[model samples]
Target: MRKLASICLVFLIYFACSVMSAEDRTIYQFTVKDSDGADVSLEKYRGKVVLIVNVASACGLTDSNYKQLKELLDTYHERGLEIAAFPCNQFGGQEPGCDADIKNFIADKYKFDPDLYSKINVNGADAAPLYQFLKKEQGGTLIDAIKWNFTKFLVNREGRVVERFAPTTAPKDIVKYIEKLL
Candidate 1:
Protein backbone atom coordinates (compact mmCIF):
# COMPACT_ATOMS: atom_id res chain seq x y z
CA MET A 1 0.00 0.00 0.00
CA ARG A 2 2.89 2.42 0.73
CA LYS A 3 4.48 1.83 -2.67
CA LEU A 4 1.14 2.31 -4.46
CA ALA A 5 0.53 5.60 -2.67
CA SER A 6 3.97 6.91 -3.61
CA ILE A 7 3.41 6.03 -7.28
CA CYS A 8 0.06 7.82 -7.24
CA LEU A 9 1.63 10.95 -5.73
CA VAL A 10 4.36 10.93 -8.38
CA PHE A 11 1.78 10.54 -11.14
CA LEU A 12 -0.23 13.46 -9.82
CA ILE A 13 2.82 15.72 -9.71
CA TYR A 14 3.83 14.77 -13.23
CA PHE A 15 0.33 15.38 -14.50
CA ALA A 16 0.29 18.85 -12.95
CA CYS A 17 3.65 19.71 -14.46
CA SER A 18 2.51 18.54 -17.89
CA VAL A 19 -0.57 20.72 -17.65
CA MET A 20 1.59 23.77 -16.84
CA SER A 21 3.88 23.03 -19.74
CA ALA A 22 0.99 22.78 -22.17
CA GLU A 23 -0.37 26.11 -20.98
CA ASP A 24 2.99 27.76 -21.52
CA ARG A 25 3.37 26.24 -24.98
CA THR A 26 0.05 27.62 -26.13
CA ILE A 27 0.46 31.15 -24.80
CA TYR A 28 -0.45 32.53 -28.19
CA GLN A 29 -3.82 30.82 -28.41
CA PHE A 30 -6.01 33.91 -28.13
CA THR A 31 -8.68 35.70 -30.15
CA VAL A 32 -8.36 39.45 -30.55
CA LYS A 33 -10.23 42.01 -32.63
CA ASP A 34 -8.88 43.34 -35.89
CA SER A 35 -9.07 47.03 -36.69
CA ASP A 36 -12.50 46.44 -38.18
CA GLY A 37 -13.70 44.75 -34.96
CA ALA A 38 -13.50 41.29 -36.46
CA ASP A 39 -12.15 38.37 -34.45
CA VAL A 40 -8.52 37.59 -35.26
CA SER A 41 -7.03 34.39 -33.95
CA LEU A 42 -3.34 34.53 -33.08
CA GLU A 43 -2.92 30.91 -34.10
CA LYS A 44 -2.75 32.04 -37.72
CA TYR A 45 0.64 33.53 -36.92
CA ARG A 46 1.88 30.37 -35.24
CA GLY A 47 4.83 29.76 -37.58
CA LYS A 48 5.77 33.40 -38.21
CA VAL A 49 7.99 35.75 -36.30
CA VAL A 50 5.72 38.53 -35.12
CA LEU A 51 6.59 41.99 -33.86
CA ILE A 52 3.61 43.33 -31.95
CA VAL A 53 3.73 47.08 -31.51
CA ASN A 54 1.32 49.37 -29.72
CA VAL A 55 1.05 52.34 -32.04
CA ALA A 56 -0.41 55.84 -31.95
CA SER A 57 -0.94 58.38 -34.73
CA ALA A 58 -0.37 61.54 -32.73
CA CYS A 59 2.49 60.40 -30.52
CA GLY A 60 5.79 62.27 -30.59
CA LEU A 61 7.67 59.26 -31.97
CA THR A 62 5.07 58.47 -34.60
CA ASP A 63 6.88 59.76 -37.68
CA SER A 64 10.26 58.17 -37.02
CA ASN A 65 8.81 54.88 -35.76
CA TYR A 66 6.50 54.59 -38.74
CA LYS A 67 9.27 55.24 -41.21
CA GLN A 68 11.66 52.85 -39.54
CA LEU A 69 9.00 50.19 -39.09
CA LYS A 70 8.22 50.39 -42.78
CA GLU A 71 11.88 49.98 -43.55
CA LEU A 72 12.09 46.98 -41.24
CA LEU A 73 9.11 45.38 -42.90
CA ASP A 74 10.59 45.94 -46.33
CA THR A 75 13.89 44.52 -45.12
CA TYR A 76 12.67 41.35 -43.43
CA HIS A 77 9.21 40.61 -44.77
CA GLU A 78 10.19 37.87 -47.22
CA ARG A 79 12.31 36.35 -44.48
CA GLY A 80 9.20 35.81 -42.27
CA LEU A 81 8.93 39.03 -40.22
CA GLU A 82 5.41 40.15 -39.46
CA ILE A 83 4.69 43.49 -37.81
CA ALA A 84 1.35 43.73 -35.98
CA ALA A 85 0.59 47.30 -34.96
CA PHE A 86 -2.11 48.04 -32.43
CA PRO A 87 -3.42 51.56 -32.12
CA CYS A 88 -4.09 52.71 -28.57
CA ASN A 89 -5.41 55.94 -27.11
CA GLN A 90 -4.53 54.82 -23.59
CA PHE A 91 -1.46 57.03 -23.58
CA GLY A 92 -2.20 60.77 -23.42
CA GLY A 93 -5.12 60.12 -25.76
CA GLN A 94 -2.72 60.03 -28.70
CA GLU A 95 -4.78 57.79 -30.97
CA PRO A 96 -8.16 59.49 -30.66
CA GLY A 97 -9.96 58.57 -33.85
CA CYS A 98 -12.51 56.18 -35.19
CA ASP A 99 -11.38 53.10 -37.05
CA ALA A 100 -11.72 54.67 -40.49
CA ASP A 101 -10.10 57.91 -39.44
CA ILE A 102 -7.16 56.12 -37.90
CA LYS A 103 -6.74 53.95 -40.97
CA ASN A 104 -6.97 56.95 -43.25
CA PHE A 105 -4.50 58.96 -41.22
CA ILE A 106 -2.00 56.11 -41.21
CA ALA A 107 -2.27 55.84 -44.99
CA ASP A 108 -2.36 59.53 -45.84
CA LYS A 109 0.04 61.03 -43.32
CA TYR A 110 2.62 58.29 -42.90
CA LYS A 111 2.09 56.59 -46.26
CA PHE A 112 1.80 53.34 -44.35
CA ASP A 113 0.16 50.59 -46.29
CA PRO A 114 -2.80 49.10 -44.41
CA ASP A 115 -1.81 45.64 -45.59
CA LEU A 116 1.33 45.78 -43.43
CA TYR A 117 -0.22 45.90 -39.97
CA SER A 118 -2.94 45.04 -37.49
CA LYS A 119 -4.50 47.80 -35.34
CA ILE A 120 -6.09 47.24 -31.96
CA ASN A 121 -5.91 48.26 -28.29
CA VAL A 122 -2.67 47.98 -26.35
CA ASN A 123 -3.76 49.04 -22.82
CA GLY A 124 -7.08 49.23 -21.00
CA ALA A 125 -9.79 47.08 -19.43
CA ASP A 126 -11.00 46.43 -22.98
CA ALA A 127 -7.52 45.58 -24.17
CA ALA A 128 -7.34 42.62 -26.57
CA PRO A 129 -6.70 39.19 -25.14
CA LEU A 130 -3.45 38.83 -27.13
CA TYR A 131 -2.04 41.97 -25.48
CA GLN A 132 -3.20 40.70 -22.09
CA PHE A 133 -1.41 37.40 -22.60
CA LEU A 134 1.67 39.20 -23.94
CA LYS A 135 1.87 41.46 -20.88
CA LYS A 136 1.56 38.45 -18.59
CA GLU A 137 4.33 36.73 -20.54
CA GLN A 138 6.53 39.86 -20.40
CA GLY A 139 5.51 42.49 -17.91
CA GLY A 140 7.06 45.93 -18.44
CA THR A 141 9.17 47.97 -16.07
CA LEU A 142 7.32 48.94 -12.88
CA ILE A 143 3.97 47.67 -14.29
CA ASP A 144 2.13 45.10 -16.35
CA ALA A 145 0.14 47.67 -18.23
CA ILE A 146 1.85 49.22 -21.25
CA LYS A 147 3.46 52.50 -20.26
CA TRP A 148 2.84 54.33 -23.53
CA ASN A 149 2.40 54.01 -27.25
CA PHE A 150 4.79 52.14 -29.62
CA THR A 151 5.78 49.49 -27.05
CA LYS A 152 6.85 46.32 -28.87
CA PHE A 153 6.82 42.58 -28.15
CA LEU A 154 8.73 40.04 -30.19
CA VAL A 155 7.49 36.49 -30.72
CA ASN A 156 9.46 33.79 -32.48
CA ARG A 157 8.13 31.52 -35.18
CA GLU A 158 7.13 29.00 -32.52
CA GLY A 159 4.87 31.60 -30.87
CA ARG A 160 7.06 31.88 -27.78
CA VAL A 161 7.65 35.32 -26.34
CA VAL A 162 11.29 36.14 -27.10
CA GLU A 163 11.71 39.80 -26.04
CA ARG A 164 9.78 42.88 -25.06
CA PHE A 165 10.84 46.38 -26.09
CA ALA A 166 9.80 49.64 -24.49
CA PRO A 167 8.20 52.50 -26.40
CA THR A 168 11.62 54.06 -27.04
CA THR A 169 13.22 51.01 -28.68
CA ALA A 170 13.49 51.71 -32.36
CA PRO A 171 12.39 49.21 -34.99
CA LYS A 172 15.92 49.21 -36.39
CA ASP A 173 17.28 48.08 -33.02
CA ILE A 174 15.05 45.00 -33.17
CA VAL A 175 16.70 43.61 -36.32
CA LYS A 176 19.57 41.88 -34.52
CA TYR A 177 17.17 39.87 -32.36
CA ILE A 178 15.11 39.01 -35.43
CA GLU A 179 18.17 37.86 -37.32
CA LYS A 180 19.19 35.64 -34.42
CA LEU A 181 15.78 33.97 -34.34
CA LEU A 182 15.70 33.48 -38.09
Candidate 2:
Protein backbone atom coordinates (compact mmCIF):
# COMPACT_ATOMS: atom_id res chain seq x y z
CA MET A 1 0.00 0.00 0.00
CA ARG A 2 2.86 2.44 0.80
CA LYS A 3 4.60 1.81 -2.53
CA LEU A 4 1.34 2.25 -4.45
CA ALA A 5 0.66 5.57 -2.71
CA SER A 6 4.17 6.82 -3.50
CA ILE A 7 3.73 5.92 -7.18
CA CYS A 8 0.39 7.70 -7.30
CA LEU A 9 1.91 10.82 -5.75
CA VAL A 10 4.75 10.79 -8.28
CA PHE A 11 2.29 10.45 -11.16
CA LEU A 12 0.23 13.36 -9.84
CA ILE A 13 3.35 15.54 -9.55
CA TYR A 14 4.43 14.69 -13.07
CA PHE A 15 0.97 15.40 -14.45
CA ALA A 16 0.80 18.79 -12.71
CA CYS A 17 4.23 19.82 -13.94
CA SER A 18 3.42 18.87 -17.52
CA VAL A 19 0.14 20.71 -17.44
CA MET A 20 1.80 23.82 -16.01
CA SER A 21 4.51 23.86 -18.66
CA ALA A 22 2.24 23.32 -21.64
CA GLU A 23 1.54 26.33 -23.84
CA ASP A 24 -2.06 27.04 -24.77
CA ARG A 25 -1.17 28.54 -28.14
CA THR A 26 1.80 29.23 -30.34
CA ILE A 27 2.53 32.26 -32.52
CA TYR A 28 1.50 30.35 -35.61
CA GLN A 29 -1.78 29.42 -34.01
CA PHE A 30 -3.03 33.03 -34.03
CA THR A 31 -5.08 34.64 -36.77
CA VAL A 32 -4.94 38.44 -36.81
CA LYS A 33 -6.59 41.11 -38.95
CA ASP A 34 -4.64 42.87 -41.63
CA SER A 35 -4.90 46.50 -42.71
CA ASP A 36 -7.91 45.43 -44.78
CA GLY A 37 -9.53 43.76 -41.77
CA ALA A 38 -9.17 40.37 -43.38
CA ASP A 39 -8.14 37.44 -41.25
CA VAL A 40 -4.49 36.72 -41.76
CA SER A 41 -3.32 33.38 -40.50
CA LEU A 42 0.09 33.52 -38.85
CA GLU A 43 0.65 29.95 -39.94
CA LYS A 44 1.74 31.35 -43.30
CA TYR A 45 4.90 32.55 -41.59
CA ARG A 46 5.65 29.36 -39.72
CA GLY A 47 8.81 28.49 -41.63
CA LYS A 48 10.25 32.01 -41.54
CA VAL A 49 11.96 34.17 -38.94
CA VAL A 50 9.33 36.74 -37.92
CA LEU A 51 9.91 40.14 -36.40
CA ILE A 52 6.74 41.49 -34.83
CA VAL A 53 6.61 45.20 -34.04
CA ASN A 54 4.00 47.46 -32.51
CA VAL A 55 4.06 50.49 -34.79
CA ALA A 56 2.71 54.05 -34.75
CA SER A 57 2.60 56.71 -37.42
CA ALA A 58 3.39 59.83 -35.40
CA CYS A 59 5.73 58.51 -32.75
CA GLY A 60 9.11 60.21 -32.34
CA LEU A 61 10.91 57.00 -33.23
CA THR A 62 8.80 56.40 -36.31
CA ASP A 63 11.11 57.90 -38.91
CA SER A 64 14.30 56.15 -37.89
CA ASN A 65 12.58 52.89 -37.20
CA TYR A 66 10.66 52.92 -40.46
CA LYS A 67 13.78 53.68 -42.44
CA GLN A 68 15.74 50.95 -40.77
CA LEU A 69 12.90 48.52 -41.13
CA LYS A 70 12.69 49.29 -44.81
CA GLU A 71 16.39 48.68 -45.14
CA LEU A 72 16.22 45.42 -43.25
CA LEU A 73 13.26 44.16 -45.24
CA ASP A 74 14.82 45.15 -48.51
CA THR A 75 17.99 43.37 -47.53
CA TYR A 76 16.76 40.18 -45.93
CA HIS A 77 13.14 39.65 -46.93
CA GLU A 78 14.12 37.21 -49.65
CA ARG A 79 16.32 35.47 -47.09
CA GLY A 80 13.42 34.37 -44.82
CA LEU A 81 13.01 37.55 -42.72
CA GLU A 82 9.36 38.50 -42.33
CA ILE A 83 8.40 41.72 -40.62
CA ALA A 84 4.91 41.84 -39.16
CA ALA A 85 4.00 45.42 -38.30
CA PHE A 86 1.00 46.00 -36.10
CA PRO A 87 -0.12 49.58 -35.73
CA CYS A 88 -1.20 50.68 -32.28
CA ASN A 89 -2.54 53.91 -30.80
CA GLN A 90 -2.22 52.82 -27.19
CA PHE A 91 0.88 54.96 -26.83
CA GLY A 92 -0.05 58.66 -26.72
CA GLY A 93 -2.62 58.43 -29.55
CA GLN A 94 0.22 58.63 -32.01
CA GLU A 95 -1.68 56.46 -34.45
CA PRO A 96 -5.15 57.99 -34.47
CA GLY A 97 -6.09 57.25 -38.05
CA CYS A 98 -8.31 54.52 -39.38
CA ASP A 99 -6.86 51.57 -41.28
CA ALA A 100 -7.01 53.26 -44.67
CA ASP A 101 -5.48 56.48 -43.42
CA ILE A 102 -2.71 54.59 -41.68
CA LYS A 103 -2.01 52.59 -44.81
CA ASN A 104 -1.84 55.73 -46.95
CA PHE A 105 0.37 57.45 -44.41
CA ILE A 106 2.83 54.58 -44.39
CA ALA A 107 2.90 54.52 -48.15
CA ASP A 108 3.39 58.28 -48.52
CA LYS A 109 5.93 58.64 -45.75
CA TYR A 110 8.06 55.52 -45.83
CA LYS A 111 7.48 54.36 -49.41
CA PHE A 112 8.04 50.94 -47.89
CA ASP A 113 5.43 48.29 -47.59
CA PRO A 114 5.53 45.58 -44.97
CA ASP A 115 3.04 43.01 -43.77
CA LEU A 116 1.05 45.66 -41.92
CA TYR A 117 -1.78 44.57 -39.70
CA SER A 118 -4.85 46.46 -38.53
CA LYS A 119 -4.54 48.86 -35.63
CA ILE A 120 -4.51 47.15 -32.27
CA ASN A 121 -4.20 48.05 -28.63
CA VAL A 122 -0.93 46.86 -27.25
CA ASN A 123 -1.90 47.41 -23.62
CA GLY A 124 -4.84 47.55 -21.27
CA ALA A 125 -7.92 45.31 -21.13
CA ASP A 126 -8.65 45.44 -24.85
CA ALA A 127 -5.16 44.50 -26.01
CA ALA A 128 -5.11 42.07 -28.94
CA PRO A 129 -4.71 38.41 -28.08
CA LEU A 130 -1.58 38.23 -30.28
CA TYR A 131 0.09 40.99 -28.28
CA GLN A 132 -1.02 39.35 -25.08
CA PHE A 133 0.56 36.10 -26.22
CA LEU A 134 3.76 37.92 -27.20
CA LYS A 135 4.00 39.79 -23.92
CA LYS A 136 3.40 36.60 -22.01
CA GLU A 137 6.10 34.85 -24.00
CA GLN A 138 8.66 37.58 -23.32
CA GLY A 139 7.59 39.91 -20.56
CA GLY A 140 8.87 43.44 -20.94
CA THR A 141 10.27 45.74 -18.25
CA LEU A 142 6.72 46.16 -17.04
CA ILE A 143 5.86 42.53 -17.79
CA ASP A 144 2.95 41.86 -20.23
CA ALA A 145 2.41 45.52 -21.04
CA ILE A 146 3.95 47.18 -24.02
CA LYS A 147 5.74 50.34 -22.91
CA TRP A 148 5.60 52.22 -26.21
CA ASN A 149 5.45 52.06 -29.95
CA PHE A 150 8.04 50.04 -31.87
CA THR A 151 8.53 47.39 -29.19
CA LYS A 152 9.61 44.34 -31.18
CA PHE A 153 9.35 40.60 -30.64
CA LEU A 154 11.65 38.25 -32.50
CA VAL A 155 10.10 34.89 -33.29
CA ASN A 156 12.00 31.83 -34.36
CA ARG A 157 11.11 29.80 -37.45
CA GLU A 158 9.38 27.38 -35.10
CA GLY A 159 6.87 30.11 -34.07
CA ARG A 160 8.31 30.65 -30.61
CA VAL A 161 9.01 34.10 -29.26
CA VAL A 162 12.78 34.08 -28.88
CA GLU A 163 13.63 37.66 -27.88
CA ARG A 164 12.00 40.94 -26.95
CA PHE A 165 13.33 44.36 -27.90
CA ALA A 166 12.46 47.66 -26.30
CA PRO A 167 10.76 50.36 -28.39
CA THR A 168 14.07 52.16 -28.72
CA THR A 169 15.94 49.19 -30.18
CA ALA A 170 16.64 50.02 -33.82
CA PRO A 171 15.86 47.66 -36.68
CA LYS A 172 19.52 47.79 -37.74
CA ASP A 173 20.57 46.68 -34.27
CA ILE A 174 18.29 43.65 -34.58
CA VAL A 175 19.82 42.51 -37.86
CA LYS A 176 22.51 40.33 -36.26
CA TYR A 177 20.00 38.43 -34.17
CA ILE A 178 17.71 37.87 -37.17
CA GLU A 179 20.69 36.72 -39.19
CA LYS A 180 21.63 34.21 -36.53
CA LEU A 181 18.08 32.84 -36.52
CA LEU A 182 18.01 32.63 -40.29
Candidate 3:
Protein backbone atom coordinates (compact mmCIF):
# COMPACT_ATOMS: atom_id res chain seq x y z
CA MET A 1 0.00 0.00 0.00
CA ARG A 2 2.87 2.41 0.72
CA LYS A 3 4.44 1.70 -2.71
CA LEU A 4 1.08 2.30 -4.42
CA ALA A 5 0.71 5.64 -2.66
CA SER A 6 4.20 6.72 -3.68
CA ILE A 7 3.50 5.90 -7.37
CA CYS A 8 0.22 7.78 -7.31
CA LEU A 9 1.87 10.83 -5.72
CA VAL A 10 4.60 10.81 -8.37
CA PHE A 11 2.05 10.62 -11.18
CA LEU A 12 0.04 13.44 -9.72
CA ILE A 13 3.09 15.67 -9.43
CA TYR A 14 4.09 15.00 -13.01
CA PHE A 15 0.62 15.70 -14.29
CA ALA A 16 0.38 18.92 -12.37
CA CYS A 17 3.72 20.13 -13.69
CA SER A 18 2.62 19.34 -17.25
CA VAL A 19 -0.51 21.41 -16.86
CA MET A 20 1.47 24.33 -15.48
CA SER A 21 3.96 24.15 -18.35
CA ALA A 22 1.18 24.25 -20.94
CA GLU A 23 -0.29 27.36 -19.39
CA ASP A 24 3.04 29.17 -19.10
CA ARG A 25 4.29 28.28 -22.56
CA THR A 26 5.24 30.67 -25.34
CA ILE A 27 5.41 29.82 -29.02
CA TYR A 28 8.37 27.52 -29.61
CA GLN A 29 6.83 24.61 -31.51
CA PHE A 30 5.61 26.24 -34.71
CA THR A 31 7.28 25.20 -37.99
CA VAL A 32 7.22 27.36 -41.10
CA LYS A 33 8.38 26.63 -44.62
CA ASP A 34 11.68 28.16 -45.58
CA SER A 35 12.40 29.81 -48.90
CA ASP A 36 13.62 26.44 -50.12
CA GLY A 37 10.39 24.73 -49.06
CA ALA A 38 12.10 22.94 -46.18
CA ASP A 39 10.53 22.87 -42.74
CA VAL A 40 12.10 25.58 -40.63
CA SER A 41 11.38 24.97 -36.99
CA LEU A 42 11.09 27.89 -34.59
CA GLU A 43 13.12 25.91 -32.09
CA LYS A 44 16.25 26.90 -33.97
CA TYR A 45 15.50 30.56 -33.22
CA ARG A 46 14.78 30.04 -29.56
CA GLY A 47 17.22 32.69 -28.40
CA LYS A 48 16.68 35.21 -31.17
CA VAL A 49 14.20 38.03 -31.63
CA VAL A 50 12.01 37.23 -34.63
CA LEU A 51 10.09 39.65 -36.86
CA ILE A 52 7.48 37.80 -38.89
CA VAL A 53 5.65 39.62 -41.66
CA ASN A 54 2.99 38.72 -44.16
CA VAL A 55 4.20 40.21 -47.44
CA ALA A 56 2.57 41.06 -50.74
CA SER A 57 4.54 41.72 -53.92
CA ALA A 58 2.21 44.09 -55.70
CA CYS A 59 0.99 45.98 -52.67
CA GLY A 60 1.60 49.71 -52.29
CA LEU A 61 3.92 49.31 -49.34
CA THR A 62 5.80 46.35 -50.80
CA ASP A 63 8.78 48.27 -52.16
CA SER A 64 9.30 50.49 -49.14
CA ASN A 65 8.80 47.65 -46.72
CA TYR A 66 11.23 45.46 -48.62
CA LYS A 67 13.82 48.20 -48.66
CA GLN A 68 13.52 48.81 -44.94
CA LEU A 69 13.36 45.10 -44.29
CA LYS A 70 16.66 44.74 -46.10
CA GLU A 71 18.15 47.42 -43.91
CA LEU A 72 16.79 45.69 -40.80
CA LEU A 73 18.28 42.37 -41.87
CA ASP A 74 21.67 43.88 -42.59
CA THR A 75 21.76 45.82 -39.35
CA TYR A 76 20.30 43.44 -36.76
CA HIS A 77 20.74 39.96 -38.22
CA GLU A 78 24.00 39.44 -36.36
CA ARG A 79 22.40 40.89 -33.24
CA GLY A 80 19.71 38.15 -33.32
CA LEU A 81 16.95 39.97 -35.20
CA GLU A 82 15.45 37.52 -37.66
CA ILE A 83 13.09 38.80 -40.36
CA ALA A 84 10.87 36.15 -41.89
CA ALA A 85 8.69 37.24 -44.80
CA PHE A 86 5.75 35.23 -46.02
CA PRO A 87 4.34 36.32 -49.36
CA CYS A 88 0.58 36.56 -49.10
CA ASN A 89 -2.27 37.50 -51.46
CA GLN A 90 -5.35 37.41 -49.30
CA PHE A 91 -5.52 41.18 -49.06
CA GLY A 92 -6.40 41.86 -52.68
CA GLY A 93 -4.53 39.36 -54.82
CA GLN A 94 -1.61 41.74 -54.49
CA GLU A 95 0.80 38.85 -54.35
CA PRO A 96 -0.59 36.88 -57.28
CA GLY A 97 2.58 35.42 -58.65
CA CYS A 98 4.83 32.39 -58.45
CA ASP A 99 7.55 32.07 -55.85
CA ALA A 100 10.29 32.52 -58.39
CA ASP A 101 8.78 35.71 -59.69
CA ILE A 102 8.34 37.07 -56.21
CA LYS A 103 11.94 36.21 -55.44
CA ASN A 104 13.16 37.90 -58.57
CA PHE A 105 11.20 41.06 -57.88
CA ILE A 106 12.53 41.27 -54.35
CA ALA A 107 16.06 40.65 -55.51
CA ASP A 108 15.95 43.07 -58.40
CA LYS A 109 13.84 45.84 -56.93
CA TYR A 110 14.64 46.06 -53.24
CA LYS A 111 17.76 43.92 -53.03
CA PHE A 112 16.18 42.13 -50.09
CA ASP A 113 18.26 39.14 -48.98
CA PRO A 114 15.99 37.87 -46.25
CA ASP A 115 14.28 34.50 -46.45
CA LEU A 116 11.20 34.74 -48.70
CA TYR A 117 8.76 31.90 -49.10
CA SER A 118 5.88 30.76 -51.27
CA LYS A 119 2.63 32.74 -51.20
CA ILE A 120 0.44 31.85 -48.26
CA ASN A 121 -2.96 32.91 -47.03
CA VAL A 122 -2.72 35.40 -44.20
CA ASN A 123 -6.45 35.59 -43.38
CA GLY A 124 -9.65 33.60 -43.79
CA ALA A 125 -10.21 29.86 -43.26
CA ASP A 126 -7.17 28.88 -45.32
CA ALA A 127 -4.61 30.75 -43.24
CA ALA A 128 -1.45 28.84 -42.43
CA PRO A 129 -1.21 27.22 -39.06
CA LEU A 130 1.76 29.38 -38.19
CA TYR A 131 -0.26 32.53 -38.90
CA GLN A 132 -3.14 31.15 -36.89
CA PHE A 133 -0.81 30.61 -33.97
CA LEU A 134 0.68 34.06 -34.40
CA LYS A 135 -2.69 35.78 -34.49
CA LYS A 136 -3.78 33.96 -31.40
CA GLU A 137 -0.54 34.68 -29.64
CA GLN A 138 -0.56 38.43 -30.32
CA GLY A 139 -3.88 39.73 -31.50
CA GLY A 140 -3.93 43.49 -31.98
CA THR A 141 -6.06 46.03 -30.12
CA LEU A 142 -8.68 45.98 -32.89
CA ILE A 143 -8.85 42.54 -34.47
CA ASP A 144 -7.03 39.28 -35.13
CA ALA A 145 -7.44 39.05 -38.88
CA ILE A 146 -4.54 40.83 -40.48
CA LYS A 147 -5.75 44.13 -41.88
CA TRP A 148 -3.47 44.11 -44.91
CA ASN A 149 -0.17 43.06 -46.33
CA PHE A 150 3.07 43.63 -44.41
CA THR A 151 1.49 42.92 -41.05
CA LYS A 152 4.31 42.09 -38.64
CA PHE A 153 4.55 40.07 -35.45
CA LEU A 154 7.43 40.64 -33.09
CA VAL A 155 8.60 37.68 -31.06
CA ASN A 156 11.11 38.11 -28.29
CA ARG A 157 14.25 36.08 -27.72
CA GLU A 158 12.30 33.70 -25.51
CA GLY A 159 9.76 32.97 -28.29
CA ARG A 160 7.16 35.10 -26.55
CA VAL A 161 4.96 37.30 -28.66
CA VAL A 162 5.86 40.88 -27.82
CA GLU A 163 3.91 43.08 -30.19
CA ARG A 164 2.04 43.36 -33.47
CA PHE A 165 2.66 45.99 -36.16
CA ALA A 166 0.28 46.96 -38.88
CA PRO A 167 1.26 47.05 -42.55
CA THR A 168 1.46 50.83 -42.46
CA THR A 169 3.92 50.75 -39.59
CA ALA A 170 7.30 51.41 -41.10
CA PRO A 171 9.98 48.83 -40.59
CA LYS A 172 12.21 51.51 -39.13
CA ASP A 173 9.59 52.06 -36.48
CA ILE A 174 10.32 48.52 -35.30
CA VAL A 175 13.92 49.30 -34.47
CA LYS A 176 12.90 50.44 -31.02
CA TYR A 177 11.14 47.16 -30.35
CA ILE A 178 14.15 45.21 -31.56
CA GLU A 179 16.35 47.20 -29.25
CA LYS A 180 13.96 46.56 -26.39
CA LEU A 181 14.11 42.86 -27.07
CA LEU A 182 17.88 42.93 -27.10
Q: Which prediction has the highest TM-score against the true structure?
A: 2
Query: Among these predicted structures, which one has the highest lDDT?
Result: 2
| Root-mean-square deviation per candidate | 5.6, 5.8, 4.8
Q: Give the per-residue lDDT of model 3 (tens digit) for 1-182.
A: 99999999999999976686533556677777776677777787789998989998889998889989999989999899888789987888998888888888888988787767667887889999888878987887678899999999998988888899988999999999999897
- Assess candidate 3 and give its lDDT: 0.85
Model 1, range 31-141, lDDT digits (tens) per residue?
666667777777878778888888888999999899998888888888888888778778888988877777788779877763333456666887877788789888888
- Clash pairs (backbone) in predicted model 2: none
Question: What TM-score would you give candidate 3 relative to the actual structure?
Answer: 0.84
Whole-model lDDT values for every prediction: 0.80, 0.91, 0.85
Model 1 lDDT vs. the true structure? 0.80
Sort by lDDT, best first: 2, 3, 1
Locate the minimum summed-lDDT window of 10 residues in model 3: 20-29
Q: TM-score of predicted model 2?
A: 0.87
Q: lDDT of candidate 2?
A: 0.91
Q: Report the lDDT of model 1 for residue 166.
A: 91
